[model samples]
Target: MTVYYCSASYYDNCDYWSTSNCTPPGTYCHRGACGTCDNSYYQCAWANLSGFPPENSIADTCGSSWLCNDKHAYDIPKFSCGTVLWVQDLCNDNGLNVTIADHGPYVCKCETNCNSVNLMRIIDLTEAAYIYLEGSFSRGHIPVMIQT
Candidate 1:
């Protein structure tokens, strides 16, 4: 996964710059925006629908025909629909086999962690899949490595 770090639109002038979060290794920052300093991927959490109950009821980008049952559906930045992703949740030490069903994280920044690649939630998961790895729906994201 390629992670890009950019300043929140609201933090327009870099006033809220955080050295550790904004300038981690292998990242670039300028004018309150940052991006991948290197092409390598890092281990980080990805956002999930479990945090937002309303999102759990929506259809995936794959199509209206696709069903998000059995915790098998997920979304990533730009993978083609139907691609299989073997996800290993780092924090929970759990693994799940999911498919790319949509496109999102439309923004890399999360509520608690902002402009930080290491804390970024690169992928988006269905509520069920998230619960499978997290054992609960309290967190907005989880750390995972995606195996194609």
Candidate 2:
């Protein structure tokens, strides 16, 4: 299912579209236009698959040898390999267009806060991508907006 996000409120789920008098399900009147949410995902971390053993490498999902070197890279769930996405960081207002190089974080690490595990986006970015969006590596994770 395609995810639709609204800026005026917390992110919501919507699907498909029709012409006249048509709005995404679960939403009121079609707002003419819908944009990505500022906080679609509450957590984003830099992916470092290269640090793992060959058996545990993300490269097995997509044969992108440049995942370690490429600053603009992505690893998101649901999207197919090679799918490109236009992403923007809500914190820094930085935008990036990149291709999906890996598929992961299937398990949300709720060790710290299991109360809101469903809110996690499970997105993983390359170190360069994270830094370009003004994320602090020491912090490990940051809230981000993904432009669909």
Candidate 3:
């Protein structure tokens, strides 16, 4: 598996669009727009995936039911879902164990924050995880080292 240590962000599962209204078979809805799935597993181009109850159409995806707790979301790819990961903040040496909850970094959208000379991957954390790592939400992004 590809391994790299990079920056990290945070996001909740609350923001998402329904795929039920999506017209094409290869696409899924996200943030109110229709986008193509990356593969048969329904992974979106932006890295988001489909598979949530109630809407049951699509979602940001999660590592476990507990990680979905609005405050513990981690937006790693689906391939990393359910995996225990170690993350250490490069700035302060603060670290914590996290699960791959969701998929993203949305590359283009995150721009320099998600990708840069020092930043390679973006691992979004939930409010709870961020707080646990002593991070400030206003900071937006933090440099971190992620390992499986």
- TM-scores for all candidates: the values are 0.43, 0.41, 0.49
Which tens-of-lDDT digit does each residue in 19-128 have in candidate 3? Answer: 35556642444432222211212121213333423122113233334222132224343443455567776767787766554555444222233233345334566556
The lDDT leader among the candidates is 3
- Cα error, residue 20 of model 2, in Å, equals 57
Which of 2 and 3 is ahead in lDDT? 3
TM-score of model number 3: 0.49
Model 2 agreement with the true structure over 24-127: per-residue lDDT tens digits: 55343422111221122222221222233334433343344333223112333334444455656554567675444443443323121112122233456554
- Deviating ranges (above 4 Å) for candidate 1: 1-78, 110-117
Residue 26 CA displacement from its true place in model 3, Å: 30
Candidate 1: pairs in clash? 5-34
Computed on alpha carbons, the lDDT of every model, listed in order, comes to 0.40, 0.37, 0.46
Worst 10 residues of 1 by lDDT: 6-15
